[model samples]
Target: MKNEIDKKLTDKNIKPTAMRQLVLKVLTEQKTATSLPELELEFEKADKVTLYRTLKTFEENKLIHKIEDGTGSVKYALCQDTCECHPQDLHVHFLCDKCKKTYCLNDIPVPTINLPIDFSLESVNMVVKGVCFNCKK
Candidate 1:
């Protein structure tokens, strides 16, 4: 697992450090998108600054993508290995209202929009809110 983590970081041109590896491990283990506060709780003695930096580094490297699910808190989830963080690579996100957990709906691509002249698409954030299967049960 450690080797796999290291390889992933290195492939993204991010130097594999202790903090980076640990944070990546946590992100990889998550079933839903996670916020900074939620990630801080995972560590016994987390350096807030370091954790923030790690997340920023990951985002910059396209190892993870941020999600704004209208919950006020920005969450992050690991990107697919082939993900380039491009507009076309973006997908719809599912936010479970009952559980308040944001999940990556990877199979569902965001619909294409025909922009007006002179307008260009940069990114799109589409979130579908509903009760997740776990909550429905």
Candidate 2:
């Protein structure tokens, strides 16, 4: 796990720090996504600002994908295997309303559209909002 994060950080040209590692470690803990505040509360030593900066860095490197809920809250989930900011690992992310977390629907790959000749694709973020199974009662 550490090696994977290290390699990703290096690829993003970001110097790995203890605080950054801790923030990433917390994100990796979930089977779903997490918010900045959620992570701050979960990590006793991580302050809100530090956690946000760490998340910013991670998102910049495509290490994680941000799930945007219409309510205006943002959540994040870990990148799947072979997520090289390409369409392969890019897909619709599901955000459970009740649980207030995000999830990568890897089984459902993102749709692709042909672009103009000069256009180049970088990364994509698709989010589906609803309540998750665990939250349904």
State the lDDT of candidate 2 residue by residue for 1-137, as single tens digits: 99876776777677889887777777777887787777878876757787788888888777877777565778888776467667666788887778666777888888886789999877666778788888887
**Candidate 1 CA-lDDT value:** 0.95
lDDT (0-100) at residue 66 of candidate 1?
96
Question: Model 2 residue 11 lDDT?
Answer: 73
RMSD of 2: 3.1
Alpha-carbon runs more than 4 Å astray in model 1? none
Please give the lDDT score at residue 112 for candidate 2. Answer: 88
TM-score of each: 0.98, 0.75
Give the Cα-based TM-score of candidate 1 against the true structure.
Answer: 0.98
Best of the candidates, TM-score: 1
Assess each prediction's global lDDT (C-alpha) against the native.
Answer: 0.95, 0.76
